[model samples]
Target chain A: MRISIPVSVGIFLLLLWEMGCRAWAVPVYILPPPSEVLCTALSQYRILAYHGSVTLFEILAGLALAIAVSIPMASAMFLFPWVERALAPFLVASQAIPVFALAPVLVVWFGYGIESKVIMATVIIFFPLTVNLLEGFKSCDRRHVELFRMMGYSKYGTLKKLFWPWALPYFFAGLKVAVSVATIGAVIGEWVGAQRGLGYLMIQSNARLKTDMVFAAILWLSAIGLVLWWLAGIMSRRYAPWKDRG
Target chain B: MTLVSVEGLKKDFDGLSVLSDFSLSVDRGSFVSLIGPSGCGKSTFFDLLTGAIAPDEGRILWEGRTISDLSKKAAWMAQSDLLLPWMSALDNALLPRLSPKKSDRERAMALFCELGLEGFEDYLPYRLSGGMRQRNALARTIMFDRELILLDEPLSALDSLTRQDLQGLLVSLQRDFGKTIVMITHDVEEALVTSDFVVVLSDQPMSVRSSYELIGTKPRLRDDSYVVGLRREILDMLGGHGP
Candidate 1:
């Protein structure tokens, strides 16, 4: 019932938009009707799927790399106060610099290939993941750590048994945020130089005034983000089952 | 024979003394309760004894050996009932066992059942009541296989009825298991009823002001006139000026 309400409203809005576009005789270049967009999506389904899959692969690969790299960086910052101190300024600066500004530099360095796109996505995802994970590590119950010390558990033992498990939920929180913005990083990377991906396809169609195809590409991007967010929610549920109840 | 002894222990925090020239000794298989007012350094004393913090000047001897670490020989249960929130009741009890074997799990389960936590083996700590969590903690302390156990106001958080029940449990565990227990509590009646000796300490720059040996067997009746007089004496020692 909850899901169906918004879905029905969305269909109603699309119908209204189609009627307005046809009645006004609006140029397709400016605003393609939802029906025309749907037709274009079906007709160009094969091309759209190819580029969509490329972007999807980049998003997943970039997120995986970010998660891998962030864990160690976050751990170092958590385990040593001095390391956190040293890296704090640089971390803040990295986040402050717009990732979009770095997209062209990444394209130039890694060449107009998937490597640049993945790196760009990784840069966007890394900051939030590290910050969230460090916060989780630092927030473990002090009494629990004291108990671990009383039991003579080693530092690594405490990290594994207590810190990591305690931080899993926070990791998922950062992952959700990263997943939402992941495609933006990939698309921006593609817009800069990539010969493939939905971003590149949208650029090509827009140059030819094929606005219907551009609208179709955008619908595909929205679907990717929605699917990734849903997958992240499922993973969080599986890993942090204890967090759900009172 | 003395099982544990602290000699001239001194401790300070940022140049203000918490414990000064404090000394104590416990007999083998005896239960001792250190009773005092708040800020009397009972926790600091526990930390010193457990090797959690090094004393400014003192010596702690466990079984005639200079104490470096008590983790192998002593198990401690603090007031908060610090059970890991993520672990099940069974796993929390088995924490002290480094590499828990099948028998270790069975042993922990048996103790858990004995403590009235039979069906709660897999329940998380947050799911259990306050009393049940403390029982789980006690099970974990006992599972450590240590002869000496330190309990820091373990029942101070429970309601009166639950507190009395757990007091009874502690008495039985000491009598049946022959464990040398050192517990700290501010409750004069609790100290007098459950301990073989009550060590009363003065507040601030804390030092042992006096110690008394209680009469009678395990779980002395709280209503007995002799125990009643002892309670008043301990309460007065705790700075009770009220008429």
Candidate 2:
């Protein structure tokens, strides 16, 4: 029933879109209907797949880098108040500067390669992951900490046994947010300057007025984001099954 | 013999005194309960006993020697079970053991059986009932393998019936294992039923208001004339402060 409701809603929306485009006599460049978009996606599968694979690599790599960086950073912040205080401004600044503005600079430095796109994705994914994880660590019950202290547990032992387990749910929540936004970073990086990727394809397709192909690229990006989100959910359930009361 | 003694202990939080000139002693193998007005620093006393916090003034003597860091000497349990939700009952019970071995697991299993949590060893804490979770916490405390156990209202969260059952368990555990226990409780009847001595305290800057030595074997019957009369006296001492 859960799957059916959303599927039905999507189909209804697509049907309405197709009929509206047809009834309005909208030019193909101005508005191609869902049918045209679907046809373009199928007919140009090879090109879409090639470009989509590039974007996928950038998204996944960026997400992996973000996780690697954020976990340690969050841990340091949690373990030492001084580290959190030191990095607090820089962490906020990383988010404050527009990614769109940074993308052009990143492309200039990294030269339109996958590296720049990956870095861009990392920049976007870092904040939520770090903050959520730190919050999770901080959320441990005072009584539990006292119990551990009374048990003669060292700081590292308490972190390993108590804080980490307590924070798993929060970590997963941050991962979900990161995965959903991961594509935006990679795609934006590609938009600024890239030899390949769905975003590059969309730019090329739009310039040539093949709006259907651009829509097709968008569809693939959405699908990739959905897949990443689903994968994170699966991992969350595997690692923190206790959080799943249902 | 006296295993632990506190002399003129004083504690303050930002200039507001909690315990002032507090003093008490627990004999080896005795079950002692601290009953006081709500927020009258009973829990603070347990914290001081465990060396979780240092007393502002005075000294804690363990085995007749002034000492700090009683944490290793005492197994502490708070009102909440403090069981890690992700861990099974057995795993939670084995927490104090840094590197638990096969023998440790066996001992934990034995503790689980004794605590009537035999069938629920593999269950996560969230799966257990409130009483069972407290039993799991108790088992964890026992796993600390310390002679002195300090409990801060460990049974306060349970229903009356469950509380009674655990009261009996605590008494038996103390007797069978020859353990020294100091517990903070608000239940007057519970204090009477389980403790060898009940120390009543006044409101903050809490000091010992009175101490009664119960003269019978525990798990004492709550309805017995002696127990009932002592309960009334303790309640009267607490006055409207009784929880």
DockQ of all predictions against the true structure, Cα-based: 0.41, 0.72
Task: Candidate 2: list runs displaced more than 4 Å.
Answer: A1-12
lDDT of 1 by residue, B1-243 (tens): 999998889999999999888889999999999987787788988888877789999888888888765656788999988887778999999998878999999999889878999999999998999999999999998887889999999999999888988998899779877899999987888888899999888886888888998889768788989889988777776665211
Model 1, A70: alpha-carbon shift in Å?
Answer: 1.9
Error of 2 at B96 (Å): 0.4
- Weakest 10 consecutive residues of candidate 1 chain A by summed lDDT: A237-246
Clashing pairs in 1: none
Model 1, A94-155: lDDT tens digits are 88988789999999999999999999899889888999899999988876787788777888
Local distance difference test, candidate 1: 0.89
lDDT measured at residue A205 in model 1 versus the true structure, 0 to 100? 95
User: Local error of candidate 2 at B155, Å?
Assistant: 1.1
Interface CA root-mean-square deviation for model 1:
2.1
TM-score, structure 2 vs. true: 0.96
- Candidate 2 lDDT over residue span A1-246, tens digit each: 989999999999999999999999899999999999999999999999999999999988998899999999999999999999999899999999999999999988999889999999999998889999999999988888988888788988999999998899899999999999999999999999999999999999999999999999999999999999999999999998877872
Name the TM-score of candidate 1.
Answer: 0.88
The model with the greatest TM-score is 2
**DockQ measured for candidate 1:** 0.41
